[model samples]
Target: MGIFLTILKILGIVLASIVGLLLLIILLVLFVPVTYKVSGEYGDKIGGRVKVGWLFASATGNIKKTDDGMDGIAKLKVFGISIKKIRLMGHDDTEDKHKVKPKKEKKNKKSGTGKAPDERTETGNSQMSDLENDLVNSPVNGLKNNTGAADTTGINGNVRVGETGGKADSINGNESFDIDGESDINKEIDRIFGTGDETPEEDKTADENSGKTADEDVNKTADEDSEKEKVGIIEKLRLKALKILEKISGTKDKVLDKKDTLIRKKDHFIEFLDKPYTKNTIARGKKLLKKVFKNLLPRKGNANVLFGLKTPEKTGAMLGKVCMFYPLYHKWLHITPEFYEKKIEADLWFKGRIFIGSMAIPALFLVLSKDFKRTRNLAKKI
Candidate 1:
């Protein structure tokens, strides 16, 4: 019985120790912060480094430009000992570095290349035959032979002028088709004016009476044109007055619509401001943002910048907007802006700590709050 009691006491102590150890580990994981540093530069070259550390473990990575391309490397360490180091972009191949180069062969020009005359003659003859066959089978040569024309062009110098609408254009100064198309255009003009050779026999026979008919037709057309001009003038005036009235009515309606929209928007904004949920949401959001900025923003940083946006006014405006966050970063930043030049130069470094335990709980509460719920439900806001 004493042995059994002793064994039981030992088991109880062991179990308690295990439970305490687990609780300690959980607390450390939840409360321990992750520290990080970021650094970068520009102008001569672009480069940067990022380092993140937690307790005894840390990882560092850096990138920089090279003659070939961007090169990057990363390293992992634990307890001040490097566990792994590797090239993040590409591996350093050692085989090429250690390779042995072959000795260059020596050439003797004393024998004048040491080739047989028959072989050289055969190669030259083959090249000559190939050239002759190419010239015989060429498309430009075929065109010259078929057309028997001196204006045939080679493949490179194709000349084309402004001819379209299914009309063939001159190629390589060949104006035969262009002349045919122009003649066709002239024929069409003559036909439309009743001067072509295809004029009707009846029209030819009636030429004697054409003078009197033409005079009467001219008088009749003049009277008709004057009446049409008067009608067109009255129509244009009526259309102008109607268009003016329509424009006025349209403008009035647009003004009234805008006024009604403004009134409705004002009323809605008032109601939104009066809601208790909205006030609560704004207050909570402001508090959360303050906490986030306090913890997330770097405690120490310096930025030296020579910048311009092509004009002094634009450069000042940009700097003004960026300086709004001066209070958050405090006095660690050093910036120099150039309002004259268009070039940009900068060197920046920042370090910050993120305590997940401190930021997570408030964020979780905010997300689960009734105000957040009301805001998410559009019906409640409306």
Candidate 2:
């Protein structure tokens, strides 16, 4: 009885250990999901728009924004992501260092009109000088304003032409204002520094000389007109020849279309007769028909030369043999009595028409006629 009690006690302790281990495993599974959620949230801050799929617990980091934009830093997941800072620089500072000082305004010189020239020249000179300095400092911006036709003098200053003590225009000194109401200095500088218009002027002079020469040839213009008329006549003849060739091609196309249609219809009729006939006899009939039809029918184009009984001699001979001996041909066709009777009737009707319209009387007349001597005389003249 004591041994049995000891066994029961040992079994109870073993069962209790098994339940405790199972509970511990369930707790670990639940805790693992929570740990994953926390790690994913931290990873969001460290890697902008990117996720670390399986990072070690010891690894991880954050990003910071600077004056310019966002900057990425080292984190445990990324280990080695790097970024650098940028700075912007410009050219105005160097340009201003090189500009010359503005010159002092000179006293006005007197002219016969009793007006002081200095009144016109003094302020305009200073303003123009300031503008030049500004253009030197910021060439790109100045160029934009000038090209856009915006006010391009120095800040709040107006620039006027023909009011300066500088060298005057050679042709018209101080006589007229510049077209753009600005100083003539720009135009003078362009004339001196920019490419001159010599080549374009030379081209215009040559064109004028050629025009004069063409006008001098006007007295003999009737001869030239006659030559042009001859050329036009040749072109018209060439075009007419091309049109004739095209018409021939169109006729060929029509002949081909007719031939293909007739061949397909004949094939269908042949197939209908085949089931009633022996294979060997049917094959022979089809072969003979194919050879005869090919010989008689036009091979190309729309117009059948054989239309309205117009076949050449070789075609006529093959067709003639087939029509004249059709009873013997039908023996080779080997069709049943009922089908053979119908086919023979159709062939007879077709042959009667052929002999009356194409072969018997008129063919005999042509054979017996004595017109060859006249035809030969006509050919000799040609």
Candidate 3:
């Protein structure tokens, strides 16, 4: 009996300690006055101030665009005591301005005729023109010289330069004539007409090789087309399966536009809950719950919410009628039913309370009980 009593006492002490810690945390959350103010334009400038309690801590910072980039300053304070201050200076705009002036001058020179051609350009152009003239004149001159010499010397005849009527048979057997120029012309002619005796065999072999390559290419292309068709069909089937799975699982692609807002076509909550319980459904539910809690929880000292509509008057009128008929709609939706303009903004401020204030205990109890009920209902459905 003594052992049992001792065990009960230990358990009671542990429970009381846990309860006391929880109360302490709750009190800190309620009493800590963390306040912040932020005002900024889209791209021009931004500034913010944050304060914790009356004199416990505070910080302030401001940044603005300069001619070059940006400049800013920040300061931190604890118990009204300045702990640190920092200043950031912008880049030197004078240097960039000087750099840009030279570029503009170069552009102006290029746009005008005052630009001088460098030596490299002049030399390259001269060399290229010289090479082109030589290439064009060499072939024509070679042909003209060869034709004149050939006409003077009949077939199977040899001509000696600076000598007239040189007979091919009369030339000394041991005499070595300079045939270099004539040989070059003959080679050029042969290259042009393909009249060499050995060329026909080479041409025939090349033709055969080309024909084989053409046939192989045709076969390879056909094979590749067939493989592509097969792959396309498989891809189509896989995509169709994925789409079907997505529809059945109530999962959708969430796309965010330039405004950083999700483009939701329909209510995802209704879609998710309507689907039967599955691993994907459960995962999606958890994701949805996380998003809900994140939005519900207070992240900073101040909160600002903005809503906009294309036709606010009509929508607000319809919503007002619904709320009039169904009072519970007002509890579920925490916004004004009548909207005068296309845009609405709300700012929320919180005042800290005692750790275990009169309202904190009941509020915490209600929150926990509601969460427990919701969890139990979800488990039953699953």
Per-candidate clashes, comma-separated? 0, 13, 3
- Residue 59, candidate 3: Cα error in Å is 3.4
lDDT of 1 at 324: 92
lDDT of 3 by residue, 1-382 (tens): 9999999999999999999999887666665544554444432233333333333677777666755667776778887788997775555445676774444545544365553678668988999999987675441332235342532232234433422333323233345444433454566777898766777788899999999999999999999999999999999999999999987665333322422332232344454355554334455456655654544444434444444454767766666665575564332234443344465555444323122233454444544554445544665643
Give the whole-model CA lDDT for all candidates, comma-separated.
0.78, 0.46, 0.56
lDDT of 1 at 38: 95
Taking the tens digit of each residue's C-alpha lDDT, what string does model 2 give over 16-127?
A: 9999999876554433321111111111132122222222232223333444445543334333443332222222345688999899999899668654788879878999
- For 199-275, candidate 1 gives per-residue lDDT tens digits of 57867768858977998999999999999999999999999999999999999999999999999878877877788
- The residue ranges of model 1 lying beyond 4 angstroms of the native Cα positions read 94-290, 309-330, 363-382
Candidate 2 Cα misplacement greater than 4 A, ranges: 1-214, 218-226, 229-237, 253-257, 260-264, 267-274, 277-382
Q: Each candidate's TM vs. the true structure?
A: 0.46, 0.17, 0.28
Which pairs of residues have clashing backbones in candidate 3?
27-355, 30-352, 30-353
Better candidate by lDDT, 1 or 3:
1
TM-score of model 1 vs. true structure: 0.46
